[model samples]
Target: MPTSSRSSEGGTRRAAAAALLTPGLLALGVSFVVPLVWLARMSLNRTVGPAELQPDVSLSSYVDVLTDGFMWEVAWHTLWLGVLVTVLAVAVSYPIALFLARTRSRLRGLLMALAIAPLLTSSVVRTFGWLILLSDDGIVNSALSTLGIIGEPLTLTNNVTGVVIALVEIMMPYAILAMIAGFGRVSKDLEDAAGSLGAGRLRCFVRITFPLSLPGVLTGALMVFVLTVSAFITPRLMGGGRVFVIATEIYDQATTTLDWPRASALAVLLLLLFGVFLVLYQRLFRMVEGR
Candidate 1:
């Protein structure tokens, strides 16, 4: 086709694409934007309980959520949990992922099955399992006591450590999956090429494999962080309701306390905190990926 004809066709295609996207844009606004706007408004409104949702707009909820030291502490606790879980999950799962990546077929399938089973289990059920294993008299303590490893059981339930472990268990599958995908994307030929050129395995990984898999690392870490930050059941159950995360707090405000405004304000704060990650992605990952 001639240059002019090509340009015209491209323009027409763009116009048609825009037209097709309008409905989706509208749906997005309705589904996400509308509730978000409602949430913002609710954040400003005064809420006595679930029943008393008045339109008397104010910042008391924001003030309350912000001024409370407990919320800040809870937020910090959740943040640390997310960071630790992300790091540990990635660190622990990478080797497994690499192993699976290298394995031919059947073993890879088995590893994949093991990695995915935890994810397939319900969160409540998983948390319950942790509770059984981590409680003072549970399997861990019984095993230790039987083995004479220690005189008594250690405290794992209703603690940060327990919560972190549960979160990590639940989130590690995603990390492994991410790493496996990442490793699949990396060409083994590159490692072979490096090896042929006198580069050792460690050197090959450092020089070639690590950098290429970073995108998957970024992706997996982000997914784990976001999920852990907003996680409700595992934290609540494993942490013994002492684990106060944004998601749990939101639940309490809206469901238990019947305080929608405060909940909405807390929700908005969660959104803002979550949005920081988008900023981080733009600044950090885009630079890494040369986007």
Candidate 2:
């Protein structure tokens, strides 16, 4: 072909690729970018009343959010809750994922089904189920009392502990699935070779299997952390309006107080904090990879 024809063909392909990507880009802008821009704008607006916000721009909302000791406490609670849920979900899912990855038995399918069964249910239903199970006079406390472990029912419901437990159940399936994918990518031959080199089962897993599975673990942890941090229904139900996270605070501001600017400000801050966490996580991953 002539050079001119070759150039024309390349241009055509580029145009085709751009055309294919245009719809997705437009959709993303409409669905995400526009809302984010609006939220940021609203955050800067001044709250004039319970039902009204003035269009005048100011940083008072953000200043209030940042300076208020209570808001800082809520932020800390949200961060720690996210971290705890991620850790618990990853820990509980790792062995299950390993089993699913290595097992060739018919039971593996049943086990996977069981793991994912909670996800098939509605979030409301799941949260209510947890409420039943964790209530002061509920099954957990009753069982403990029956076993003489406690003289009275413990305050498990409407607290951080209950929220963590519920969130863990909701997030565990995702963690397991991610880890299973990672574990599947690892070659069994590598593990066998480690064993042949006089490594015990635990040593082989630690040095060979676990390291190889880090990518999946990290991915799952990130997912769980984000979900936990953004969770509204589970925390609301499990915490019984007593445990206040950012999401709950946003809800109260938007609905109860009718302060759109304050709610928007909180939402923006939440996004910024998550953005910071993502950057730090990426840096940490890169450092681990470098080592």
Candidate 3:
């Protein structure tokens, strides 16, 4: 073909690709970019009253959120909660994922179904179930007391511990599914070769299996971290107003105080903080993988 004809074909293909992507780009702008711009504008406004916001632009809200010691405490709490939930979810899911990956039992399908059954239920229902289980007179306390673990029912509900437990349960299935996919990609031949070379099961797993599965583990951890940090429902229900995280604070500011500007400011801060953490994490992971 002539160079002119090839160039024309390339231009046509580019035009067609751009045309096909236009609708998706427009939808993304409408759904995400527009709201983000509006949110940034709102965050700059001044709140004059409980239900009133002035059009005048200011940084008072940002200053208040950033400088306030209480806001810092809440941010710290949210951060640690996210970290704890991610750790627990990853720890709990890894073994289950390994089992699913290696099992040839006839009940594999049933086990997989059981593992993911929680996700099929509404989050509200799951949290409520945890509420009952962790309540003073609930099964956990009853069993612990029966085992002489404590004289009285320990305070499980309406606290950080309860929140952690519930969040772990919520994130476990996602971590497991991600790891299962990751484990599936790993070749069994490498593990067998290690065993044939006199490596113990644990040694083989530590040296061969675990490193190969790091991508899945990292993905699950990041997902759980993001979800836990941004979670409103689990914290609200499990914490029972005593435990205050950034999401709950934002909710209170927006709804109860009707301070949209302050809420928007808090949201903006949260997004920036999360973005920074994510970038740092990805860099660290890349560094580790490079080694």
Candidate 4:
């Protein structure tokens, strides 16, 4: 083909791509950008009374949220929960993901379905189910007592422990899926070659498999962390009013206390927190990719 024809074709493809992307971009702007802008503006406004917002621009809301010790505690708790959930999810999902990635068993499809079946149910329903299972007199405690593993029923619900347990279960599927995708880049041939060179299974995995899988692990961790931080339902139900993370804090301010400005400020801070982590994730991802 002539250069002119090739250039024209390239330009046409570019135009078509842009045309296809326009709708999505516009939708994102309208749904996400507009609300974010409004929220930022709302955060600057003053709150006069219950459900009453003043039109004046001020940083008092942000200042107040920053100075509030309880808010700081909530923020710390949210971050801590994010970290804990991400760690546990990754730990629990890694072996499952590896098995799914490498196994050629006949039951692989069934096993994968079982692993992800929880996702098909409503989170509210799953959370309620957890409530039943983790309660003091629930099946878990009864079974543990039957096995003589414990002499007493454990306090699992209405606390951080219950929230952690539920969040780990909720986030594991996401981590597993991410890791499976990452493990796609790791070839069995590489492991075989390492073995041929006298590398033991454990050593080969530690040096080769795990390193290659970091991308997937990191991706899953980031996803779980973000989701865990913003999670409201599981935490709210599991915490039983004992746990107060950012999401719950925001809900209480916006609906219960009717303080829109404070809620908006908390929201803005959450966004900023997300931004910082995203930046760090990008840098670490680049380093892992050797870019």
- Global Cα RMSD, each model: 3.2, 2.1, 2.3, 1.7
Error of model 2, residue 27, in angstroms: 3.0
Clashing pairs in 2: none
* Candidate 1 residue spans exceeding 4 A from truth: 1-31, 48-53
RMSD of 4: 1.7
Instruction: Please state the error at residue 63 of candidate 4 in Å.
Output: 0.2
Candidate 3: lDDT of 104? 84
Candidate 3 runs further than 4 Å off: 1-23, 104-110
Model 1: what TM-score? 0.85
For 150-198, candidate 1 gives per-residue lDDT tens digits of 8978989997789988888888888888777756556888889999999
Residue 137 in model 1: lDDT: 96
Worst 10 residues of 4 by lDDT: 282-291
Model 4 per-residue lDDT at 12: 100
Please give the lDDT score at residue 86 for candidate 4: 95
Q: Model 1 — which ten-residue stretch has the worst lDDT?
A: 282-291
Q: With candidate 1 superimposed using the best TM-score fit, by how many Å does residue 104's alpha carbon deviate from the native?
A: 2.8
- Angstrom error of the Cα, residue 32, model 2: value is 1.4
The parts of candidate 4 lying over 4 Å away from their true place are 1-7
lDDT of 4 by residue, 49-168 (tens): 878889878999999999999999999999999999999999999999989988999999999998888889888898899999999999999999999999999999999999999999
